[model samples]
Each structure stands twice: as structure tokens, then as C-alpha cells.
Target: MLTTAPFTELAAQMTGRVVTASDSDWDAVRQAFNVTADLRPAAIALPRDVDDVVAAIAYARAHGLRVAPQATGHNAKPLGTLHDALLVDVRALQEVAVDPAARRVRVGGGVKWERVTPLLAEHGLAALHGSSPDVGVAGYSLGGGMGWLARKHGLQASSVTAIELVTADGRFARVDADHEPELFWALRGGNGNFGVVTAIEFAVYPVAQLYAGTLFFGLEQAGAVLCAWTALLPDLPDEMMTWIKLMRFPDIPDVPAEVRGQAFTIVFGAFLGDEEDGRALLATLHELGPAVDTFAMAPPGVLGDMAMDPNDPLPYLSATALLDELPDSGVEALVAAAGADSGSTLTMVELRHMGGALARRVPGAGARATLPGELGMFSLGVPLDEASAVTVQAELDVVSRAVAPHKVGDYPNFVEADTDARGFFDEDTWSRLRLVKALYDPSDVFRGNHPIPPADVRSL
Candidate 1:
């Protein structure tokens, strides 16, 4: 029923590369972020601009092909990689422009946070970016990006001023609350269901420097450190942000020999205030005597150096949950399941503190009708062993149950290999997202790795 003519014509209209089954590089191009998500889509369109994206959508609709959009090919990469679908790799659209006058930045959907971060830093500005700079801006914000700046700036979606999208019918449209109100809302916190976003204009902050870095502790001191951290967080200035990571680095050069190849308690921090004050505040942390305390007040780029997640292509899978409470029982369960000691093969388990700016939603800003409430716990489950992935999940589930009653929702970005995330979020959010899907992409022609539940479907 579909003809190659439309695709051929559409490909000619685009500036970037177009890959098909006949191409020699097709084998390597189809796989999404996770090396394991290798599926044979009908074709892959790497469009350079909004017009190209629009044409690709037109061709896909004519050919009865589904569409998917990807920026970084990470996260529910399915959020971008359509299965047996026409994959639109928008990386060529990558561009970052800062509007100092408006205190905003307009970035191509394909641009990663890394590309945007340093540019903003050059201008004494900062975007409420995610933890890792590798994630695509669109996919990251669509999942309510609860990243490092979250405590100070709230959801990244909340800051978006404008968005350009290529819709189901191949129409290019601009999105803002006053414009396509419903679709705008859905694209913010809702997973990619509305259309293929080409670029986004969002707010940034004047974050010139900060006292920030990580403090690594021996596994034996996890409990004492956790208590000390809890006491410190409430008292610390809002400028400071912190998270606890229980992970083992796999004996890599960048990793320390003592902490590498084993588990440890690492305190990740970002102190936005003066260095001396920040250092003084850390006195208690040092008194606890961590095995490796790498704490310091630093410049904008320092955040990247401290967390330093691997940029190399990695085959990974993860899961996440938001907790309303972290009871003593929950702590015990986490320690029991994930273990206080880090011999487990899990790469990292990150627990971010939410609230502060994360709690306040901008008035009439976006169609982000959904977000978890204030001051809850969050957890990430990363599996290192393919054979043991299931077992690792079982153990993580134990940690999850330790605080299940308090689980409000799952962080969309962390919904790794699992595609059944409909059960993780709230119903209102789902309904709102579906309404946006109807308004902007009624054909359901773009079902990718992360399929938005059809509006008519039953709830999980």
C-alpha cells in the first residue's frame, strides 16, 4: 500500500542523511541509545530542519509508516525510537542559541544538554539541565526532567517559552501556552506523543559559579553518612543541591582504585553560594570522614566533572520510582536489597532530593498537568549483567517495596528497557497527554519505543 516514491521525494527535500535498508550503514543506524534496542525500522530519516521533519512526517503518513523522533537516543529512547517504524534522527537539527535579552535559550531538539550548558555558562547563564549532559533536550523535558537544577528552577518543562514541532500531518507549528495550549502542555511533561519537536526556547538562570562536587565514602559508613546528610539538607541553603549515589565503578582509569570495582556511598553536591561558606558547611561532612571527599565550590563546568557519567556507548537498562516517604523501614529495606556494601553488580543507584524550586509550578506556563508532589524519595535501578537483569530487578523491587506505599510515580527518563510505564504515572497526566495526542497527532502514526497509551485504552 505504501510507495517508496514519497520517501524518496521527502529525502531529497531534507538536508541531513537518510538511511534505508539498502544502505550499508543501516545495520548500525537502527539501534537506539541502548546498544541492545536494535530493531529494523522501515527507514531512518535524519532531518536537518523543521521543513525536513515536516516532509518526513508527510511521507510516513502517505506510506502508512509510523514516526519516532530522537535527540540523544537515550532515556526511554523508545520515546524516540519507533519500533518497525520510520525513525527520524533529528541530531542534525542540533543548535543552541542564547537570547540574553530574554534570558532564554532556543535549542534544537537534537542538541544535548552538554552542548547547551557550556554555551550558557559563557554568558554567565545556566539552564535547568538534567543530570547527564548526553540527554536530548526534548526527550529530557518531556519526562519532567528532574535534574540537578530542579531544586532551584523546578521542572525544565516549566521553563520552556516556545517549541517548534512537526506534527502528524506534516504541519510545522509553534507551541507556547497561548498558542497550541493543549499540545504545549502535553509535550512538556507528557512523553513524546504530540509531534516531533524540532527546537525549543526555554529559560535559563544566572548561575556563574558554585561550590559543588562529590564526596565518596566507604560502604561501611553508608548509615552514618545518610543520617548526617538528612540533617544537613534541611539546614543547607537552597543554593546547595545534593544526592546520594550507591554505585560501583568498574575499575576504569577515571575511577579510583579503592572505590572502583566495588560499591561505595557517594554524596553528590552543587553548592551555589560562596566557596568559603560552602566549605564551612561541608565541615560536618568531612568530620564523618568519607573515604574520598572531593567536595569543593566550583564553576559551571565543574558539575559535569564531578558526576562524570561515561560518554562512551554503553548497553544499559534502568528503572525509577518516586516515593512520598522514606521511612526507617524503607531505609532498612533499601540497605537489605540494594545492600549497604557495594559488591552488587549495579552500576549506580541515584537518590535525588526534590522540592525547593521543583515544587513551585509557574502560573499558566505549560500543559504539564502532571508532576509528583513535594519532598519525596526517588531511586534508580541500573543493571550491569544481562543474565542477572531480572534478578537485579527483583532485588530492586524489594528496595521499592521498602517504600511502595509511598511510591507516587516513576521518573519517565529512568524507565529504561521496560516499555510498560503506563502503570507508573498518574491517570490525570495520562488523560491530559492523550488529549494532546489527539489535538496534535491524532493518527497515532508515530508510535515509537515508548508508546503513549492510546486514549481509548483501559488503565493499568
Candidate 2:
């Protein structure tokens, strides 16, 4: 446990409040997006601005404390958990400024995409932010965010105009493609390995709304839907992104009577272009028999309902794989493992179609995506008891092996909890990342979320 005595002097010096277990709000502070991450951090420092973050980090460094930088807390993560940890909550750092003329948005690390999306919409523009509006802008973008408009704009990170980070060694640096180039490479997909990113500026797209939402089908029809969906997605325009989801809507009156409480296949899509062309593109899917057709013009805020991903944590565990070829054999393995009728207690199996604009990389994109195409990405959401993490991992291991022939760049998100920061990047990638980390964070700080594993850890 962290003693308050040693840090009382330091706490009195900062503008942000320093809370400990003695505070009545300690329970609230300990709560994470995923309830599984129930940990009492030694100090919860609410930094009101970038200067506050600097002060908090300096205090941590002075006391040899571990610092975990967080915003929105939506990653279902475990990077900052120790009782002795210094929790740097960046929520007060929220800022969203749109350079409408330049087609860009410079969002503070603490800002949620929801705040920016609407502001951009006012200018008849939108950034390719993730589905969850509750998710932080900088945190998600740094992971190469994937979302509905992703195909049209490419990786969110690729849109980055600049990033401002407080290096581990306690120096503030603003990096971009042209300046501090090495640090820029690691920031894109290196997770939060190098330092605390306080602000990020990325390119925004002109988009108001789209033909988006779910088209649901019965569980029995999942196989047929998957086959047809895969064949149709590759022919899609760059302005559209498509995905197939196998899920079971809960039995509740709030849910429509048609899709409530039954295993179903929901085709969720987003078309970034005009409506008429989008409808023509989706004519084939519209022909398919759906129990419920919630597909229509919708705002970005409600997009989460389409995926129906739980906002609250239950016993959540998931594993995913990137595929090189979505051949019949691979599809067969997928269906057998987590299909509609596969009684594996899995909540949903999602197959996201990649490629399209995704193939075009920034001049020197950080992560060398091993698999590049308009074909596949796998997501299986399973909810079982906490004790079943081992069993779920074992089952997922089998599934990963079954599709090993298709392994590509791992999703920092899909399998986040399963792999530590070390395993997130491959050897060559991690090696290059370490050299950059050493250059920026020479004092061995930045050991929080999506951390750069130690030189020893990365080498192994």
C-alpha cells in the first residue's frame, strides 16, 4: 500500500486533487470501465490541464512511483492497477478545436469523440472516430482506430497531424511526421509506451450522417448470411464499411419483439457517401429476409446500439485473430467455434471486412499490417464467470491456432486483455519501438496502458 505521509507535501503543491482510500469517493475512483479491473490505486490525481499532468508526473518520479495515464477508461484494460500506482486521470484536459478550413481536429487527450463528432457535423465534417463516443480521442486514435468511416479515411492514426506528449524523462515534446519522426512512428501503434499523450491533431472528413444500423436475421440463417455477406463486401466502394455480427438480443420488452431473445445474424454497415448509391450497393442485403431492419439514417451517438456491445461490464473475455485468407476452411473453423448455433456461450462473433482505403498507407505507417485486404478480422465476445478466464483463453487458443495461417497485425483492442503490452507487437516491430522509446523515455517511465515492454521484456 502507498503511504500518504511521503506524498502529502507533494500533493499540497499541485493544482489537481489527490485522492486516496480515505476519501469518500475512493470507490468511484477505483471503478474501471470493465468491473474486472477493481483496483484501489494509491493516488487518483485529476489533472485539470497539461501543466497539472507535468506536476503529477514529476511527483511520481520524485517518489519513484509508477504512473498510469488514462482518459475515459473504456479499453476493458488492466494496465494501471497496483495499490501503489499513481493514477493520472486526464479528463480535465478535454478540448476540441476544428480547423474547418483545413479539415482537421486537434482534440485534447481527455476529449471524447462524441464531443468532436457533433462539432464536426456542424461544419458538415466528421473524423473517423471509433463507434464508442464515450471512448477518448487520443487513446483510441493511438491504437489505429477502426470504425464505420474507417474505410473512407484510412486508419485514424494515419490522419494525425501532430501529437503532444510529456516524455517519461519529464520533457514536453510536440511530434509530427517531419519533427521527432522516430517518436511519431511509435505513437501510432506503440500503445502508450513512450509517454503521456496530452493532445493529438488529426485530419477530419466531411460527413454529416449515413445509411447505417443493423439488419437482423434468425440464428438458423447465419451460415447463409455469412457466405453472401463475404462475397458482396469486396465489391463495395471505399465510402462504405461492412461487417457481419452473430448475436443474441436479450429477452427484454425494451428490445423489439422480433429480435428479442433469439440468436441472430445482424449485418451492420456504414456508408460514408450519398444515400442513393449506398442503397444501390446494399440492394442485395436488403433483399435478404431480416426479422428486424433498423437500417436507416442515424446519428453517430446511437451507433453503439447496432453493435449492442454492453456498456456495463459483466464477466467479459474475448479473443480475436486477423486473417490472411478467409477461405472456406477458415470460415468453417470460425462457424464451428462461435457461430450462431455453436453452443459455446459466446455472446457475439464479428467478422469485419478490411482493405478498401485501408490498403493506402501513410508515407511511413508505423505498423506493417501483415494482412492487407478487404477480407477479414475476427471478434468473439464471450461472457462467462470470472473463474472461466483460463477456460476461455484455452478455447480461444485453439481458435487462434486454427486460423494461424491468417495471422496479421493484432488489434490493440480485440484481444487487449489477453496480451500484455509486450506481446502486442512482433519482434522486429517491438525492437524498432524500443529504440524509439529509449530515445524519448530515457528515464524508464511510461509503464502504463499499452506500455512498451522493458528492453529485456521486448527482446524475449
Candidate 3:
């Protein structure tokens, strides 16, 4: 059995603080980015550096406890239970080093997109970061990050040059294409299943500015907007990417006054080109006469805030799927499920255009080299209470059913629930991932949001 006495000794060997249930700040220390997640771990270790991470892993192993490495916990809902696990919070490992000349960046596990995007913009460079700037760099890249530049540059995982982590055996190692190649592939998309990642180095692009913005239409135009957007997908070039969303903005102080308490069908996009070409590409969308048009030639930093993702934690339920296609019928079904008169209280129902660079596998790509789909559908609802939760879930189900016929596969990063990790890979890929798991973490000392068991254990 575990006790506070043993933890005291373990804490002495580390430079950072260790918080147990008895600590006064236990509630704060154990909290996840999703307020709905109820994480009750055996203990929480706040690591300050690589040595601290090694110390935490050693302590967990000696005490016969599993370790779960977490940063911002954006996907913590999938962690489920951690009764016998030590939650290694790596938020204190905030290190950012950018090489402007080389177009490279090395960041700590705790670093978020918000911390680096503006800085990269100053150097006329940008990383393949997602809509939400608050998302951690390590977790995002490991789980196959997709963003505004995704269709142009592919996934951020492919850009990863190296990963520095402490293995399950409490040994520090760096894996890349030249060293521990198989392990390197697994870590890119296998998430935290192998070890506690301390730092990651990746490549960035020399992009100072781009033509990007949004077009907002009344809720009544949802059906028309989606139909036009679907037709426009085939002609869009690799340098351009777009997403259409049905959003019902809440009436709150945090929300912009102009959009608060309003519902709209929004079309947002980013293009790695000049204004004339970008505007020509979106000429069809402009003909619809949107209520608001904010398109302009903006700096790369503006892409970070264009999505307007919530800055604070909120209780919400979400669903996602990779869609092969969204025909006219699918658009009609979607409008009937979540449009103006559908009676859906869901906060957002979005469909992101996929393909272009996202469809091709680069030379040194990792496990998640390419996502197989032309469109990615994501829907979510904010549930404030038990009654609201039920309504939100039912509406989400309806929206999901509408697009069920076109689903090709699922993106592991967007899958927010506990599920078989094998579903994310092919038979050959699954076998190799398990083999790598057996070689490095046979005991399964580390647990990721989507756990991948070793081959030996699966055979048993």
C-alpha cells in the first residue's frame, strides 16, 4: 500500500513539488483543461526539467504505480480513471528555442501554440498549429496535429525531427530517423504510450503573411452555405484551406458584443497567397452576400486567433469523424439536424476541408503519415447541467447520424473517449506499434489517452 511517508522521500530526490490528495492545492493541481473531467489520481508530480521527469518515473516504478504524462490535458476525458497512476504534470517544463535561420524550433512538453506563434511570426516563420493556440506543442504533434496550414504542410508529426523522452526503464534517450527509428515512428502517433516526453524539435515554414478571415451569414443560410462550400472543395488548391461551421454564440461577457447571443453559419479560411488570388478563389462564397466579411491579407499570427476557441475551461460534449465526401444529400441532412429550425442547442457543428498535402505521405512521415478523408466533421455542445447533458448528447447523435454514411475513418486526436487504439491504424501498422511497445515498455508502466498494449500482453 502507498503512504505519505514514502512520497516524502521521493519528493526529496526531485527539484519540483509533488502533490498528494492531502495537499491544500490538490484540487487545482489535479484539474484538467476540460472542467468536466474528474481526475482523481494517486498523486501529481510537477516536473521542472528532464532530471525531474526521470526522478518521477523512477519513483512511480519503484512503488509499483503506473505513470500518465499530461501537459494541458485537452484530451483528458479519454484518460478515464487513474486510481493507481501518478499523473506527471509537465507544465513547468516551459522551454522555447527558435532558430530563425534554420527554420527550426525546440520546445518543452508544456509549451503551447500561443507561446510560440507570435514569436515565430516575428521571424517570418510558422509551425503547423491547430485552431486553438492554448494547445500544448508536444501532445498536439504526437497525436497528429491538423490546422490552417495542414493541407499545405501536412501534419506536424511529419515535421518532427527528434523527440527527447525518458523511457519506461527510467533511461533518457533521443529518438529520430537515424536513431531508434521504429520507436521514433511509434512515438509520433502512438502518443504517450511509450514514455514521458520532455522536449520535441520540429521544422517550421518561412511564411510571414497570408490571406485569411471569415464570412458570417444568418442561421437561415446554413443549408445554402454548406452546399456551396461542398462544391467548392474540388477546385481549392493545396495552398488554400477552409472550414464551414454552424455556431450559436452564447450571450456572455467573454463573447464579442457584436456576435454574442447570435447564431450564424460561418465560413473561415486561410490561404498561403496574395489577396487577389485568395479573393478570386472565394468569389463564389462572396456572391452569397454574407452579413459580415472580414477577409484580408493578415500576418501569420492572426491565424492563431481566427478560430476564436474558448480561452477558459468549459464542460462540453463532442463528436468527430473523417468523412470521405459530403454530397448534396449529406448537406441537406446536416442542415435538418443542426440548422436554424433543427432545435439544436449545440454550440458548433463544423466540417473542415481535407486532402491536398494531407492526403499524400511524405518521405520521412511517421505512423500517422496521412489521414484518409476529404472532409473532417466535428460537432460539440456545451452542457451546463444533467438535463442539458442529455439534450446535448441526443442532438449530437442526430448530427452524427446525418454524416454517418460518408465516414471513412476516425482521427485519433479528435476521438475524445476511451477506445481500442488499434482502430486508428492498419493491420501492419498496428502489429509494428505493438512490437515496438513490447521492446520498450513491455510492463506497460506508461499509459496514454489511447493505450496501445504490447504484443506479448495482447497474446496473453
Q: Which of the numbered candidates is closest to the native, going by highest TM-score?
A: 3
Instruction: List model 1 lDDT by residue over 313-348, tens digit each.
Output: 666655567765565555655666566553445666
**lDDT value, candidate 2, whole model:** 0.71
The regions of model 2 sitting more than 4 angstroms off are 1-6, 252-258, 297-306, 364-405, 418-428, 454-460
Which residues of candidate 3, in runs, are more than 4 Å off?
1-6, 457-460
Residue pairs of candidate 3 with colliding backbone atoms? none
Arranged by TM-score, best first: 3, 1, 2
Best of the candidates, lDDT:
3
Error of 2 at 331 (Å): 2.8
Residue-pair clashes per prediction, in order, are: 7, 1, 0
Query: Which digits, one per residue and each the tens of the lDDT, describe model 3 over residues 1-460?
Result: 4433438877898899999988999998887877788888888899998899999999988887899999998989899868888999899989999999999999998899999899999987889999899899999999999999999999999999999999999999999999999999999899999999999999999885599999999988999999988899999999999999999999889898999999999999999999999999999999999999999998898988789888788889999999999999999999999999999999999899999988999997888888999999999999999999999999999999999999999999898889999999998888889999999999888999999998985565
The alpha-carbon deviation from the true structure for residue 358 of candidate 1, after best TM-score superposition, in angstroms, is 1.7
Q: Cα lDDT of all candidates, in order?
A: 0.70, 0.71, 0.91
TM-score winner between 2 and 3, please give it: 3
